[model samples]
Target: MRIVQEFTKGFWKELPPFKLVLGLCPTLGVTTTCYAGIGMGLATTFVLVCSNILVSSLRSVIPSKVRIAAYVVIIASFVVMVEMATQAWVFPLYKGLGVFIP
Candidate 1:
């Protein structure tokens, strides 16, 4: 089905970071620890998904000139929230990660 194809295409063909190699530094560095790698990957995925949704919703309203700034602000806010949540609830993992996070 076309719908299934649309969804499945991303799995092997259009991965934002893996396929495009967009965030190689974090990908390579975080992957040393399996837990840390998974956590960071999920965090990146969350930010990407949230930013996509927000930008899609505001696409018509936002001026093209400032879209990059808008997207950065949205992504940064989510990252901060994630960082705080990790520090508060998973202090051990947070400590293990060290400066990679903050």
Candidate 2:
């Protein structure tokens, strides 16, 4: 089925550091240690899911001409919140990621 193919493809066909090939900069930069990598990954996943939901919910209302800007604003807001949370609770991670999160 199409759903199975979609799930399986992520393992090899479209997996990062291989076929997918996008966003390599961040992956390489933050993956110096397992803890740093996992921390950054979870934070990123949270922001991505939140931003996706916000974007989808507002898709109908956002103007076509400024959709890109609107999406950026939505994602940026979540990023700021995540950065603040990390700084407050996980100072080491926030410091490790440094300029990457900003």
lDDT of 1 at 75: 78
Model 2, span 1-102: residue lDDT tens: 998888889777777677435655565679888888888888888888999999999999999999999999999999999999999999998998888899
For candidate 1, what is the lDDT? 0.78
The Cα local distance difference test for each model comes to 0.78, 0.87
Residue pairs in collision within model 1: none
Badly placed stretches (over 4 Å) of model 2 are 1-19
Residue 68 error for model 2, in Å? 0.7
- At residue 64, what lDDT does model 2 achieve? 100
- For this target, which candidate reaches the highest lDDT against the unseen true structure? 2
